[model samples]
Target: MSRSVAGPEIERLIQLMARLPGLGPRSARRAALHLIKKRETLLGPLSDAMRVAAERVVVCRSCGNVDTSDPCTICTDAKRDPSLIVVVEDVSDLWALERSGAVPGRYHVLGGVLSPLDGVRPEHLNIEGLVSRASEPGVGEIILALNATVDGQTTAHYVTERLSHLPLKITRLAHGVPVGGELDYLDEGTLSAAIRSRTAF
Candidate 1:
């Protein structure tokens, strides 16, 4: 059995922080100590922010982006082009595209790719919502901006099949993405190039 070096509250904080992406046990401990050192300056503010986020953050109804609003800021932007909808595998991919500033349009997040091996299926994703959005007026193009993985490609193909009957063009990102690269890990230049060089699917 492991002995606690700190109180239960501090140990609990470390455990929860360790669960965050890119954070391990040692890193979480370091972070917790840092936060404790800066209790009034950082820890308090961070706790308040996290509380607000936990209480108010929501999944966007239109694009599946996590935000404080139902449609999200991207979906509600009137200046964005309604004719173009960039379909991504997750909200992380949507944020990556937004960081590139290459897409002047809205987005549709699929939540995840089709991974039959992992039991993920079409019904598990937001595909039905995407289909309904594509059928709406002013939606002229669908850009499948998914990662370059087997599951991503499979999801793209499935999405293409579903949207094939619509009176709109379907396109995909260029080969700037490596065979197994994810959008979130890519730099802005590569993502921008991929978006600019997208071709018909």
Candidate 2:
């Protein structure tokens, strides 16, 4: 009998792994078999790692980033430009920008964009935190690096309206970003070019 068919425990494991991003039921079964075959090499270590991460991982208090520390490494970094802050819809977008090595300023992740159709609103995002950051002394610029989607544009316009009274310079990523595309899918060169050519929105 197959390991998964042998017990409820193994079956449950396969079911859960199947739910992961790219893994389907067949792949999950194959992965479970592979992990069982190399139990010491993969399964044991993976279980331990997941447990540790689940216990230790927490949101960065200041920026809402997933990290072991409170403020996150970026927020605590003294070398990063505190005068400027690039706002991203997700941490994945932040990672994409970092991979390009084009942005010198610090980042603030919005977690997600405003999509009323999907039940997401301004209150669902980190707009209040962003406004507070903008009001901070020595902060000069706020760059919106949201995806070039309808909801993204709506969120950007909303943020701009909220911060209009602030003296900080507000800017958005350039139009080079393809419509309906995500920053996480863009190449480093493309992301760098878009950021360099950024204009007010």
Candidate 3:
């Protein structure tokens, strides 16, 4: 059988930290020790922030974003292009796009992609909301910003089909060679995509 070196409170902290993505038992242990050592500077603030987030964070009803508001700042922003909607697989993707400042309009988070093997179906995602939003008169385009993985492509195709009936243009994030990337380091898919998506100089 295993043993407990610390009290239940400290051990519980380690267990909880281990649940975070990219954190395993050893990493969690190190993190827990760091937090404990810096309790006054890091742990207290983090705990308070978590408490506030738990209390106030809400899933936006219109776009499925997590924020302190229902519609979220993005959905309510008057400056955002109402004619375009960038569809992403998750809030993380939405944040990434926001950081890049490449998206020209509001966003619709699908919550997750369609992974039949993982039992994630259309009903499991926010596809119904997307279709409903796409039906609106002002929405003229939908840009699928999903990853290039098989599951991501599958989900994008499914979403395209769902929104096809609407009188709106649909686009996807272009796949190609990345800037400053060596040709030899890239895989076949990237090289092929770069050739297929070649643009004018």
Candidate 4:
């Protein structure tokens, strides 16, 4: 089998799309072709949306979640409990927790876990922000909703160690999180079970 050169512009689009998570060269090419076929409906709008999002999206000042504004809607929501904050590794995990509707507390997105192999370190994440949040006046507990991977557990332990001085009760999600599984992939039932059965660290 042979593939034709998709011209420079299409090739550029394919390259950019291929860089996205879960998108390979073949998938990127297919998506690019689809976009080209429906340029008015899909490609043009997608290009404009991506440009706008790139310009406006910024990290939430409080929780590090990606938002169009500095203090994201979740961080500014007055109805959320200040006494309980769920710590997650990334925005996707935070969104997963929200979808489950298990915790009503605020969230602190760590940006990512500590993965030494990938050159991710404690300082690279929002560990200091988490520790500071734990020591804040109203915080009583911190639910570590990180993934169940080795790196996730290691990051959790590191966070726990950093906040040992704070009075807040530290807890980890229960074993409903499958070994090497991310929070985003778990079902609502499984996520609920994990939260309910969360043990003290």
Candidate 5:
């Protein structure tokens, strides 16, 4: 018969926080305690920010990226190359690529990869939107930056088949060993991909 430490409100907050990604019950309890201690400085401001984000944050209709605007900053940026579009599985993937600063073009988020076992299909995803976007003029190439999983490759193949009639070049991200990875530590799939995609040196 262990006694509960906090009141209903605090316990509710901790429970809610625990539902967030990467935060478990123990971490959520610690976070809730910290927030309670810093009610005025951290907690209040965070609550306000979350409320504002909840009100303003929206999914970009065109590209499927989450943003405060419809077209999103990436879509509206004039400096980005309009001829190229990198297709990713989610907004998180888009953000990862943005951090790299390697892509000077825009992005198209597919919402998710094709997973038949998980009941995810082409109709459930933004595949139609992608096809429509690819059909638009000034779009020359589409780079698929999907994960190297079976679902990701299946989605890529489906998209490629759908867009085959369109006069556009479709490509996928290159797979290989990491920059400093040793041969002994590398997996067979990675080794095969590295060999297959080897460049002329």
Candidate 6:
């Protein structure tokens, strides 16, 4: 039988680290060793940061973004266009879009896509909150920036239907081949979207 190399406490830390996204057992072990070697500079600060985040982080009531405030920094930003709202799948997607700096409007995080096979339904998402926000005065448009998947499309349709009676104009992200991407390597759906959404050259 193989004997355990690290003490129980260290082994527990490695196990917990392995559970983090993009980390596996081997990588976690390496990370744990590195942290131990740099306990003062890395591990100590990381532990403190994690504790603070765990204690202070909250879901924004207005846009569903995760932050230290109920309304979140994005929702509270007066410079952003309150008339427009971009609906996304998750907090991660919200971060990605924010990094792009392409959107000057506020955002609404759905928390997840509609995946019936995965037991995720409309009720499981933040659809009602989105409807409520869209109904507010001064809101003019809602842009669905969901993924190019069947579930994403289904959720978009459902949201559009739910807000159909409202005065807001509902739109979706344009689908097409990405920049610097080759047509030969593009998927059929992307190629078709590119053809259909072709612009004046």
Every candidate's CA RMSD = 5.8, 5.9, 1.1, 5.8, 1.7, 1.5
Q: Give lDDT tens digits, candidate 1, residues 30-141.
A: 9999999999999999999999999999999988999999989989999999999999998889988999999999999999999999999999999999999999999999
Tens-digit lDDT track of model 3 for 106-193:
9999999999999999999999999999999899999999989999999999999998888999999888888899999999989998
Highest-scoring model, TM-score: 3
Query: Between candidates 3 and 5, which one is better according to TM-score?
Result: 3
Q: Residues 62-146, candidate 5: write the lDDT tens digits.
A: 8998899998999999999999999999999999999999999999999999998999989999999999999999999999999
Count of clashes in candidate 3: 0
Summed backbone clashes in each candidate are: 0, 0, 0, 0, 0, 0
Colliding pairs, model 1? none
Task: Give me the overall lDDT of model 2.
Answer: 0.88
Write model 2 residue lDDT over 1-201, tens digit each, in one string: 344464787798888999999999889888988989999999999999999999999887677677788788888988888899999999889889989998888888898999999999889999899999889999999999998788998999999999999998999876567878899999887799889888899
Better of 2 and 3 by lDDT: 3
**What ranges in model 2 sit over 4 Å off?**
1-6, 177-201
Q: What digit string (tens of lDDT, one per residue) describes model 6 on residues 1-201? A: 125689998988998998999989889999999999999999999999999999999999989999999889999999999999999999999999999999999999999999999999899999999999999999999999998889999999999999999998899989898889999999898899899999999
Of candidate 3, the 10-residue stretch with the lowest lDDT total is 1-10
TM-score of each: 0.86, 0.83, 0.97, 0.84, 0.94, 0.95
Error of 2 at 182 (Å): 18
CA shift at 78, candidate 1, in angstroms? 1.0
Off by more than 4 A, model 5:
1-4
Per-candidate Cα lDDT values, in order, are: 0.93, 0.88, 0.94, 0.89, 0.93, 0.94
Instruction: Estimate the lDDT of model 5.
Output: 0.93
Candidate 6, poorest ten consecutive residues by summed lDDT: 1-10
